[model samples]
Target: MKAIVLAACLVCMSNGAEYVVVVSKKSSFGALSVSQIRDVFLQKRRSLGEQKTIPVNVLGHDEVRAAFESRVLGMDRNRLNAYWVKQHFQGVTPPLTQPSFESVKAFVENVEGAIGYLPGSMVDAKVKAVYEF
Candidate 1:
């Protein structure tokens, strides 16, 4: 079992896939915690302080999205589906989805109060990375 776990970790590390949570450079938030990021993505909290927050989602099958969901949000697909269904019944909606990480990054850069996660390598000066995983 330990060997299997180690092998999986090695595979993940070998992929060189690192992820970052970013907000527009103009956003008031800085260095947010993982829990805060989770809340933003889950729509549990709408704003960071007085700034209205918009959370963006990358393509559903992207590895970055998978990493964010597992490492940051701490939930699997089944749980997320159930949670969203429950929230939907309550008139709550999930974050908006983008076709790719580049699209997500672009949206975050152009939109005030926007927050999203993507490959760390995709980050640039227009956005501030608030968290990494």
Candidate 2:
């Protein structure tokens, strides 16, 4: 049990989900404030230009989820889990979750008003990372 625990911890530390806030390279929208970014990620957005904001997530068990919670929302895992539970009961689904970074980038590129984070290595011509956390 201890070994399993230690291994999981190691994996968590080493394989955090890496992602960046993306914008269309053609977009004139300038740098977004932390509060604005948070609002988008938290589904608190009113609009992003003509379209709305789309918040994307990685897998439920991914390290990026925990890292993003802490870095973006200042919430820890247990608290975030509780938050989702409450939101689900309230009929408010959280952000869309992709199984891999590749899917995240693809979603962002194909969808307008859509912004998401994916692994750093998955970046390409389709999107520009405005911020990284």
lDDT of each: 0.89, 0.73
Tens-place lDDT per residue, model 1, 1-133, is: 9999999988877665378899989888989999998999999999988999999998677777887888999998889989999999999999999998889989999999999987877778988989989
Q: Encode model 2's per-residue lDDT on 3-86: one tens digit a residue.
A: 999999988765643666776666555667777877776666747667677788777777766776788778887887788788
Candidate 1 is scored at a TM of 0.86
Best by lDDT: 1
> Against the true structure, what is each candidate's TM-score?
0.86, 0.73
Segments of candidate 2 deviating more than 4 angstroms: 1-19, 26-28
